[model samples]
Target: MTTPVLEARGLSRAFGHVLALDDADFEVYPGEVTALIGDNGAGKSTLVKALSGNLAVDSGEIKFAGEPIQLTSPTQASALGIETVYQDLALAPHLDPVQNMYLGRELMRGGLGGAVGLMNVNEMRSQSRVAFDELGATVRSLTTPVGSMSGGQRQAVAIARAVHWANKVVFLDEPTAALGVRQTKNVLETIRRVRDKGIAVVFISHSMPHVMEVSDRVQVLRLGHRAAVLDAKHTNMEELVGLMTGASTKGAA
Candidate 1:
């Protein structure tokens, strides 16, 4: 009976004639992985955006750490230690790992150096290296541009960066797309490490096998709302697919 770290009820969002999120309800607990899966246009993306403060909900209630709060902007969410890593990874292709890690929130030097717009490059690099090491990410060279790295390495860097800054919740969108077996294994291991840090990991994916393998609880979305929230251990992929396709209603939340 652990309290959910993040919770939403009656969430709705519309785009002209289309309803992206229709009274969707979702929850994720601290220190556990929650998978959000659905067919195309089933409101998975919409719900992620709503909870991450990238999109406003037309109607609903959101509770963070048992307190109702409004996420008016991405900054507000970040302040609350909420970070989202989209499928794109959002890393700067040209910048190195250290640079990309502190892309927006760069550290400034002290006093005169700070007044002259000098960055604390050494400190940033040190912290970046520590983060990579802590996450068990294999980065041969932190100085190389992320564009040159393999997809899995780049994914590790992106996830490591998010985990370093996020203390409460991190929403990952399709972290293991198009990765080789070894690379995918590394990425999954990194996720377990993040969860062990007492952070809520919301994994959004279309791969049922990956979802079933990594998630503690699977929340299925159909049409525009939550169809079922089933224990991942007890539910099979066939049941998840059935719930997503509206072919079965045996596991309604």
Candidate 2:
């Protein structure tokens, strides 16, 4: 079998005396979307923080591409080809899509020693459009500020940025939250496109129907522990809900 793109074994995290996450195991395969579902306070956010290198793990191991790695910071995670799109869809409201997409990792031209080093604005604008197109996003122009775009458009831009830059895995937190029906459909389709690109995706959401529609597998967390892991094809929403609520066993009923 091929090695998973990302894996966590016995992963745990704590804050003072509170155990935010117990020993949790997860695997994300290439070209698949794995949904992480749980109720509020189930440690979903905590696990994401640890996996994305925003919080330190108290124990367990994290392996990326079959190699053990210590992710000390978000930069380390990004360097390892892991990108995260938080619930807020972190984008500068005042910046255009092209500018927001190339915010931190801007492309530049010219030699390191010369003053010729300048932001390649044209290249970024052109490439950003291509990425958006690949995701089936009908972004009319990349010059519109993010704040002026619709909620779905903003989410699309955020996802496009991750897919365009990250080579390994992408973590999406509550990606479709607060989106209208049409907008939600658009974001979900974009996610499917990302998975089809052979990049592993960790989709975190509380909506069972959405999870069932897009995920290949589902991992349920309850009270800081992994309550169950099941094939999405074999599980129903009731079973998943039971698992997340800690009413069902690991394999669900």
Q: What digit string (tens of lDDT, one per residue) describes model 1 on residues 1-253?
A: 8889999989999999999888889999999999999999999988998999999989999999889999899889988999998889999999999898898889999999989999999999999999999988988788999999988888888898889889999999988887899888887888888999999999998889889888999999998989999999998989999999999886466
> Which candidate has the top score in TM-score?
1
Best candidate (score: lDDT): 1
The regions of model 2 sitting more than 4 angstroms off are 111-117, 251-253
Worst-scoring 10-residue span by lDDT in model 1: 244-253
Residue-level lDDT for 111 in candidate 2 = 73
lDDT of 1: 0.90
- Residue pairs with clashing backbones, model 2: none
True lDDT of residue 127, candidate 1: 91
- TM-score, cand. 2 vs. native: 0.94
